[model samples]
Target: MQSTVNYLWHTDDLLGQGATASVYKARNKKSGELVAVKVFNTASYLRPHEVQVREFEVLRKLNHQNIVKLFAVEETGGSRQKVLVMEYCSSGSLLSVLESPENAFGLPEEEFLVVLRCVVAGMNHLRENGIVHRDIKPGNIMRLMGEEGQSIYKLTDFGAARELDDDEKFVSVYGTEEYLHPDMYERAVLRKPQQKTFGVTVDLWSIGVTLYHAATGSLPFIPFGGPRRNKEMMYRITTEKPAGAIAGAQRRENGPLEWSYSLPVTCRLSVGLQTQLVPILANILEVEQAKCWGFDQFFAETSDILQRVVVHVFSLSQAVLHHVYIHAHNTIAIFLEAVYEQTQVAPQHQEYLFEGHLCILEPSLSAQHIAHTTTSSPLTLLSTASETPKGLAFRDPAQDIPKFFPKVDLQSDYTTSKVRGGAGGSNHKTPQISQKPARLSQRCHTPNVVVGLCLPIPQPCPFSVLPWRFSSVSGTPEIEEVKRVTELKSRLRALAEALSRCSHRITETQLRLSNLSSELLKNRDQVHADRSIQKIQCCLDKMNLIYKQFKKSKMRPGLGYNEEQIHKLDKVNFSRLAKRLLKVFQEKCVQKYQTSLVTHGMWMREVHETRNHLRMVSCSMAAHNTEAQGVQESLSKILDRLSNQLLQDRAKEAQVSPSPAAPYPSPALTDLVFHMQELCNEMKLLAFDLQDNNRIIEGLNTPPSGS
Candidate 1:
């Protein structure tokens, strides 16, 4: 049973709800096109007539990809109430995306940029039309999935908007408290007796707050309590904080206050992006009205970044993201080549898909193939080659073989046996192990041979036919050599076990360190709470002391009044007490400020020490891995020599006999070393992540000294 709106739109699903209107997802009967119908409630009619007409006229006149389109305004069949048919955004609002758990710290860098570009473009359009969207926030901005699955953000919800030029001013207060201008906040939210008019820069303040939220998950100026519950504190933070200093406080019930001055470590934006972006935030978020950046300057700075091509290449094979930045004029070939540099996949072997469509690459197309790609919907890179690409395949160990063994020197052919019947008394010749046991194996089998595995077993030890070597010695040469190889294998196994233990230790240390850091952050919140509570207590004590004196003074015999006079006097007394309380709080909170500064300094030092310890652990793990790799490489060479010798011995021996000897199963030593190096690389990446965290912490902790 679908409900119909305006007799034309069949509505069933609800898109969103607000104080004045509820939006529904509807479809046109004739066209079968989906649309969003904004059905206003009775409360919306209570507004001034001019305000009601302004929203429809503004939406009707504006036309831009970044601004939601107003299709038609009609009256409902039953109630004869006005309903606005608007463009439907399937992806919902940016607010919903930020609410996702993965984005709790903020949007990923690329997605944030997309939000930035769209919002800036939309605002520019609004300004050009002499319209000021007084109530600008994430919820008012809707997202639509564009051609390539790219997200297109459009400014919507023009209910609070009005046509006001740069020179004009708006006295009426409108906007969410957290993102509102301080002047509006003082009169509208705080209910303070002050008259202030807002200029176009008010939108800039909202934009700053909105951008900060999109870049880092939360609002910039948050008090110990929230904006609504403690409006005065919110006002104070917004007005008192300098430009670029984000102030947030956290606490448990009755706990100390923990104040933050900069972006959190959890923010996903990269430093490079932050360097360009922080200044924009600072300029627009300026508390001083005159100092804030206008729309032109904001657009100019953002346009520079938006003009450069930013392509996010997603590797479907490895499930990795590679961010590539290039000029708009660069060709698709250069783009693929850049992807190759990052992924090690050859350009010919790379198959890319954009929005589920196979991209047709032509040298003439230029960079348009990737100029519009975004992180939300990236170019999917797939491998077409069956075998591993060049530079990615394992190296051949034979090429690395040296000319001589550590204890015994051999001929260039890796044989040490001497021939009796030659021009010289004893000419060296590569020998057959069955007829004459190779001197290389004979020397290795001897107890006197000092073969060091750490030093390369450079020459091949072809001990294949040493068992039938016809030696005059008591011990069998084959058995002795086998014993030595078995010993080396045992040592190699022990080294591998040590490496496994080290990896486990590193994992455990990382977990413990992470837990410690979480606890430290929690403690800071408690401290903030305690300081806030202490300031309140001090203010209350002074207020109580003054009230007692006032009560005492009023108790005099001369203090008498009628019922009407007494009531009026009571109101006066309350007013005086309120002003006194405010004064007391202002004077007492100075100590809290000093205390917070000291606490912040201590917290920074602790974080530095923690980061230093993390580095130390990373270095130790790297050294341990280096030692393990050295041992593995040595064993790899020995195993290769042993496997080759056994194969040769069996082949030679099989020619003489009808039966063949059992074959030995050689381990994949090369693969083992490759995996070990991979693990080391993974650990190095973890170390880099920790370093990134430290840099974010430093950025947050070290605010401008003057600030």
Candidate 2:
């Protein structure tokens, strides 16, 4: 059984409870439509009448998808209590999502973007209506699952909101403590006795805090004690000049605060996204309202991001993956052109496969629509040609290799094809090919004169028929040989790329290692345990020197004493004085001196042990890096040979006449494949070694268990 709120709506469940009102999931009995009913309690009714009136008026005037929809206002039957029926958001608030353990580090990029777009839109609407939602934290934003499965965030909880224009100011303080601006925090949270007026930028401050929290799971400007318990410190942190602009106080009292302008490594957002996003965050989170970005600039930048289409593409020919962010509203043709720019594969040859079906290459189709279909997986880019069928094993490589050697074979053919007139005015005749092995360049142009291959001329190969030259002799052994040559060439290029990436990674590792070593040495020198003991020992040495200097001096008459008193300082009195002084010194300094000696010894032992371990680790790393460099040199040599062999094979393929039953895999092709396999294995081993070395370096960089 459901309880009736006003006999017209049935209250099925209690949605949430707030300070002044209790919300419930209610259904209209007459229309059978679900809605959220905000039933105001006695406390809510007791609030300032103007505030109540303003909230109702603001809600009534505003209308946006990003803002919760207000349905109707009704009164309860029993006590004639007032209630507001609004759009029901079934997904709850963003706070619940952030509270999950998986999101402890922050929301994932996609979800964070959803939050960003929605909040910006909602705030834009509020500004347009001349209302400031003084409370703009995550809890005030409700979530709903759209028909397309995207999250729709709506700004809610308007109890603290009011009408305020851009130039106008409001004296009332209202907002969450953590997200509050410094001026508001000073007056509202710290309860300082000061009067100040707030403009529309207060909402920007709250939005900044909300975005930071959405990007990084924790609030900014945290104190050693929490924001509530140490309100003064929080205020100081927020108000501190210069560094505090993009800084947070240490959560614990360990050392001086080290301000970082960048987000932590734990944040899930990519570096490219972070670069664009950090500037927005910096602008919005500005401590000075004058320096902060207004709604116009903020909207401009954020809309720029929202408008970009990010397409994830996978290349079937090269076996590489790419994320293409197109900065335009692109059609399918434009999108494919963008992919061609990234992958170097022509748009004509590009065929995309989404959800195991061929994506229509209609030029008018929207790229964003295709992206939506492939959200679960990347769009597969396939190489296509008219001569070779789509499922051929070797056609893609054959089609792609010409892109690499577009001029090499053609130039050789042109240069070696020219024939001079015979001495007796007889016409020169082409020679017949033989079975004997010959140099590739000599064989290519011995039969015909093909000139002007290197110069800027129309391409000798017609792209309409086939992308490769071997298409002239299709269904022959020459085609098989051409396929084999292209395959090996493709493998060689891939290997070279792998080697380059490996070398780059090694260089980065070496740089990181050097930095870690420098940091370690600096820390050892500046923050060493022995330094404390050394300071104590230095103080003791100074004390001993002063004592000796005093002992060597004669009894001074001018040492703040009368002549009779000085004379009265006999040996007995002096001995008694010395004894008391010694006793006090023993009580005060002797134990400390002993403890310092022990500490010094312990520190020395630990330092020596650490140094020895570090020395061994460094020696091992040096040896490993030396071996890696040697392997890299060897791989480079192998790659050069493979490249030369591939060029020669292309030249030979251009010269060889078609045969019906020639061997499928020639000895040269077999040998080429073997060398490639060897190079690949060596690269794999090198990769494993580099990974191990990285782990070792990482271990050294990691701080000791409980620093």
Candidate 3:
């Protein structure tokens, strides 16, 4: 071993001694780097060769950030002794720190964080790399002091490390007694001595114990003494309260150890500077691992909080504006067109105005049409044509307007009438009044003067004013119609707004659900992979047990069966039964392993699908929310416009002269308003329902326990 060490290093300084090996601080002559050399005392153990081989195999393959680096191995003359070269840590073991007079009691918060972080990081790294540091304790961890006085921790000692698959029975109890899990002790007591099996969860348990020690400056379960007392304390660790409770109990019994006699004074000073220490410590000391702030839960909670913060930061007002503009524009156009059509106008003029901007038309019309038709003037000619026959006669010049005129001719007969009145006097002069037709013609031809007679004006009918009054009344209905249309539009807009908001919320929730599912799957896959390794290990353990039994039989001459007898026994039916039993057990193990794999795979797939579905739903919800927001804005705008128009219409009605013939208000406007409100309410309810469903789906997608 000395010669082998010489070959790997220039010089070695003895640092510590153990029952099985002597540890030396050495400088690698070839690389000019410091390294620790552990030389095994081969002669001290019963199966030294096997132990050395096992340790070497495990250490060579085990590579983790927290674990000590195994550089090389050397064999001595006659292959009797073996030396292992590893990375050197100058700060020595955690055991040294704990034993120091300045830190004998406990480390403060800041110092504890550093220690815990390093240790957990190392352990997590090991687990990630499929290695378990079965013997984690203060002695196995080395703290390296840097030039700047900062300390770096490294996990050491793989002498007791076993590959997860190695089936060799570890009859000799390993690991520090106080940190051993309860199952280890139980397995040791079983009659058949069932092989001990453990996974990465054991490392976490050790970490919990280590944390307790760091906090209290004493092993959580162990009382001061030697290995024997430590063993008794381990029994209590397995059977008693959690690590924190144990530490607390010990602290109470020992009284407060002073800083000078325990941990460094700087540790306490550093802890006092931080306000978050108390809550952090409480979380770390939680009894239930599930409840503790582990990686899974921490990430999940952080993500949720961040999402909410982001939503709060970004305003959603723009969505509302867009909806309001659209709704108002549409409603106003429709009302204007309806009002224009109600006025008495020529068909051609009505068409012209309909095509023009006199009314807001449907969106599809050409700009040219809008320019031509919209006008405020009423068609008085058409109104008069419909209201009176006299107006129609003027409209049609060829009609009989002369039928109301009288046909009268008075010219030559007037002179005859004068002669008759003076008949008595003219009797004597009648013979002198005779005249010829030619003479009369000549008299008439001398330009006769005709006088025009004015016809008496007809009396005014009471109902003649009705048409004008009706026109005034019609104006009221037009305003009412506009108001109603606006109200309906407003309600529709509100409904849309509500839906949009709900949709947005749903979308966010779905995203969170998806992430949760992914994490859950990853965790399950890890667990399944671990189980596969365990099944193989179990099979090998069964084989080893058989080998040990066979070896025992061979060592006892009387107990051993004769070669001929053994051959005969192998030929017997019992041998076949034994072989069958082995095959069955092997199959059973394989089946169990396969079943677990399949179950986890299916579960992961289901979780992924469910999350994806939830995400889609959330997206839908977000869209709905956006729509709802728009609807709400539109509704508000429409209502405002409707109210304003109604007020204006009422004002216009008040200004118009009221007559008995005035038209009544149209009820369509009121009905439209009522319908719109009902629609808006229904939409709001639908959006709310959608939001609720999305929330429920998100909840379902989250992992029941882990996250």
**lDDT by candidate, in order shown:** 0.58, 0.58, 0.43
Q: By TM-score, who's the top model here?
A: 2
Q: Summarize candidate 1's per-residue lDDT along 503-611 as a digit string, tens digits.
A: 4544454454445445434544544454433443443444334333343444343434463354345334433433443443334333333343343333334333434
Error of 3 at 40 (Å): 1.1
Candidate 1: misplaced stretches above 4 Å? 1-12, 250-262, 309-707
- Candidate 3, residues 47-71: lDDT per residue as tens digits? 6566657777877776765667888
lDDT of 1: 0.58
Q: Is candidate 1 or candidate 2 better by TM-score?
A: 2
Q: Which parts of model 3 have CA positions greater than 4 angstroms off?
A: 5-12, 30-32, 43-45, 48-51, 62-65, 77-80, 165-172, 185-197, 222-227, 230-234, 242-707
Using Cα atoms with residue i matched to residue i, what is each candidate's TM-score against the true structure?
0.46, 0.48, 0.35
**What would the C-alpha RMSD of candidate 1 be, to one decimal place?**
28.6
lDDT of 2 by residue, 332-434 (tens): 7887777777667798767665543345566686665564523236666555522211110111111111111122222221111110001000000000000
Poorest stretch of ten by lDDT in candidate 2: 423-432
